[model samples]
Target: MNQFIPCGLVPRLAVTVVLVLVAARCGGGGPTTPPPPIPTLTIACPTAEPVQSTDNNPRVVTFGTAVATGGVGPLTTTCSAASGAEFPVGTTTVTCTAVDARGVSALCTFPVVVRPPPRLTGTRFLAFGDSITWGVDSPPIPAAAPSFAYPEQLQQRLAARYRLQTPQVINVGEPGEQAQDGGIRRFRSVLLQHRPDIVILMEGTNDLLSLEVGIERGIEALRDMIREAKGQNVRVLLSTIIPQRMNGFRVPNRNPFAVLVPPFNDRVRALAASENVPLVDMFQVFAADMSLLGIDDVHPTVRGFQVMADTFFEAIRANFEQQVAAGVGGLP
Candidate 1:
C-alpha cells in the first residue's frame, strides 16, 4: 500500500531488499541444489531350489521373483525365464538385467538345476559291437567265446565293486556286421530284449575296413544307435575303434584302410560331444601300447582287454557307482 516515505527510509528499504537478494544468490537463504545421484544399480536374482525330474527328462521349474535395487527412478528389469519354465535334467541358467533411464545396466545370473531320478537305475549292462566285442584275440577270425574279453572283465570289475548287486554284462557283439545293417537296424530289438541300464557301444571297425560301407555311414549309424538307446532311457558309454596295424584280414596284404583310423576317431570325439554322451577313447589307449594288439593287428591281446576293462571300470564308477551321500545319490 502507498504510504508516507522519507528519502533515508526509502534508501534503507532498497538496501535491505538488495542484501536479501544477495543472500539468496550466495546459498544463505533459499533451498540448496541436490548432488547428482550415485550409481548403485544391482540386479538381484533369487536362490532357487533344484527341481527333481520325474518321468520326463525336463521338469517344470518354478522360482522366486527376481528384483532390481538401488537404481534411479524409472528403472526397468527383465528376466530370461518366468517362474514356470521347463528345465532339462541338468543345469539351466537364468539371467536378470536391470536398466535405468540413463541406459545404465546391471546383470545377474542364477542357475536352475533340474536333477534326474538316479541316472543309473538298473544293473543290467549290454556290450554291443563287432568282432572286437566278440573278442578275436590273436587270429583265426574268432576265439569261439568272448570269455576273456573286455566285457567279461568289465562285468567282473563292476561285480567286485558293487557287492550287493550282481552286475550282468551281456556280450551282444556280432562279428563282421556293419553299423547300418547291423547296429542301427537291430539296435531297438536288442534294447527291448536285454532291457539294459547301460550300453557299451564299440562298433564301426568293420565299416572302416569295408569297401561297401563308408566310415561316415558308420558314424551316422552309431548316432542312430545312441538315439535309440536314449529313447529307451538307457545310458550309453561310447568307445572309439581301437587302432589297427596294417596288413589285417590274415592275408599279410597291407590294410589301406588303416590310415582312416585317426580321422574316424576324431569324428567319434565330435559325435560324442554333439550327442552329449560319455566317450571312452580306446584308440588313444590302444595306440599307446602297440604290444597290446594281437598278431592279427586288429584284435586286442589279453593284456589289452584287461586295460580296456580298467578304463571302462573308471568311467562306470565315476559316473554311476557313487556311494549314496547327502545331495549326491548313487546306485545301490
Candidate 2:
C-alpha cells in the first residue's frame, strides 16, 4: 500500500547536508574571527640611589641605567627627568617608563637626593696690613702648607676651634707700605671688593721710620681705615706691632726707633679702646723676646709668626664664639 522513494534523490540530499556543515565551520560566508589576546607589562625596581653632585646650588642628576621589562616587543623608553639636566636641591623623583608598539606601558620610580653644600662654606677674612700681614719676611703660604704666616695659622686655628668650615684669609699686604698707603689708597676698594666678614688691620711700621712724618700719621691712617671698614659693616681686629731686633741680636743703644715703637703701640691700644674694637696685643708678648724676630729687625721668624698666630687666634676665638652664641654669625 506504501509508495516507493527515489534512491538518487536520497543520495543528493545527503551530499547537500554535508556541504552546509563544512561552510559553517570554515566561516566561508563572512569574515573570519580569532580569540582576543591578553595584554602584559612589567617594571623592575631600581637598585641604587640616583647619582648627583653635592653643591651649594641645584645641579644635574643622571640615571640612564634604570631597567624595564616585558611589554609588546620593540619598546620605547623615556624618563620624567632628562639625564644631565639641572635639578633642584633635595629629594627629586625620577620616573622611567617603557612603552611597546601596542601602547602597553610599564613604569618605575626612584628618589634622588641632592645634598646642599656645607654651611658657611666660604668664610671670608681680609687680612689687611703691611708686609707682615702679607706674610712677609716669608711670603704667605697656602692654608694647607706646613709653614703659615700669622693669618694662615689663624685660619687653621679657628677651623680647629669651631670644628667646622675652613676660613679664607686674603692677604692684601704690601711690603714697605705705611698706614697712609693702605688706609687711604687701598683700604676702601679692597673692603668693597672682597666684602670680608673681618678685616685684620696691622700697619704703622714704615710710618714710624720717618721721624718727620711721625707716628700720628700712622694712627690717623689706621683710624680712617677702621672707620671705612665699619662703614661697610665689617668687623675689625686691630693688632699691635711686634718687637724689632737687628740681625737676630739685640739692637745697640741709641736705637731711636725703639722708643717710638712702644709709643706707637700705645697709640694703637688707645685707638682700639676709643673705637671699642677688639685688639690683638702682639707687642705685649714680643717686647721681652727678641728671638721672635727674623733676620730683618722688623719681620718675624717662623716661631714669631706662630706666636703671632696664637695671639690673633685668641681674639678670633672670643669674637667668633661670642657671635655664634648670640646667634649673630657662624655656620649658616
Candidate 3:
C-alpha cells in the first residue's frame, strides 16, 4: 500500500536525524587516539682536550661552551660534574645529559685526562739557615706534616710536580744561631751528613743582631760556606736576608733592625756575584711587600713562607732543568 506523508512531517524527521548524528560525534570512546610523538633530545660533549694549567692539584674545568641540539620544549643540558668542579688527576669520565620539558633525555660522555706536572732532575735538597728558616715568631704555616717551614713546603711542591720521583729536603735550621757559627762549622757537618745535590743557603739575619758578628764577618762566613760546598762538589744557592718589617703597632712600623738590611743585602749580593752562585733575592720579595714579614719583624708570615717555597722552586727548577735534561745531575 502507498503511504502518503505530509511535507512538514518530512522536515521534522530530517531535523531529528541531524541531531542524533551530532550527539554521536560528541560522545566519548568514538575512535582510538594516537600516542604523542617522541621529543627530540641530543647532547655533544667537549671534543677537543681543554688546555689546563700545569698544576698537580685537581683542576677546575669549564664547559660553558658545550652545547646540546634538537630538543623539544624548554631544553637544558646538565652534567654529573657541575662547571667549576675540581677533577682529580687522571682520566675522569664526565657525562652530560640533555633533557626537554617532555621528560625526554639523551646523554653524552667525554674523557678528561689530567697529567701530573713535569718532573725535575735533582731529588736531594738541603735547606740551611737560622731562626727565620725555623719559622720563628711567625704565623703557623699550613702543612700536612709537623714541619711548616720552607723546606717542607718546598718538598710538598716538588712531590706535587714530580710524582714519579721521591725528593728529600732536609731543613737544618738552628734558632738564635749566628751565621759565623752555623754557616762555618754546622753547615759542613750537615753537608757531609746529607750529601745533597743542592744547598739552599739563607742566613745572616741573626748575624745582624750580634755586635760581634758584623756584616764583614757575616759575609766571610757565607763565603766560607760557599767554598765548602764547592769543595764537596755540591751546588750552593744563596738568598739575601729579607728586611725586617716596621712595627705596625708603632706608626712607622719602624724596625730598628730595618736600617741594617740594605747594607747587609748588598754584601750578600756582592758575595753571590763574586762566588758565581745562583741567587734568590729574598730581600726584594719582602721589600716589595712588607706584609710578608710578621709582627715580630724578623720571621715571615704563612703566605711569606709560601712565597719562599715558590721562589726556591723557581730558582731550583730554572737552574737544574737544563742540566738534568742533558743527563748531568739527574734523579735516579
Tens-digit per-residue lDDT, 1-332, candidate 3: 12333333344545665545544545522577898875467787875354333554667766654577775768888877766677665667778888888778889887665544556667898888887776664644422323657888998988776666777788888877878866687888888998998899999877777543478788899999999999999998899998886555445554655677788899999999999998999999888988887766677877888889899888888876432111111111
Error of 1 at 223 (Å): 0.5
Candidate 1: minimum summed lDDT over ten consecutive residues — where? Answer: 323-332
> What is the clash count for each candidate, in the order shown?
0, 0, 2
Enumerate residue pairs that collide in model 3.
246-253, 247-253
Q: How would you encode candidate 2's per-residue C-alpha lDDT over 33-132 as one tens digit per residue?
A: 8866555777664533433332335666655555656666787777777767776555666788888878888888876666443333236788877777
Please, what are the lDDT tens digits per residue for candidate 1 over residues 1-332? 23434333344556666655555545567566899877699888987787654333567878887788777868898888878877666666788899987788999998877765433345899999987887768654357556788889888887766655678889998888888687888889999999999999998888876643577799899999999999999999999999888765567643666778878889889999999999999999999888878878878988888998899888887777644321322111
In order, candidate lDDTs are: 0.79, 0.70, 0.74
RMSD (Å) per prediction: 12.2, 17.2, 11.4
Candidate 3 residues lying further than 4 Å off, grouped into runs, are: 1-119, 139-146, 211-213, 247-254, 323-332
* Each prediction's TM-score versus the true structure: 0.60, 0.56, 0.60
Model 1: residues with Cα > 4 Å off, grouped in runs = 1-121, 140-142, 211-213, 247-250, 326-332
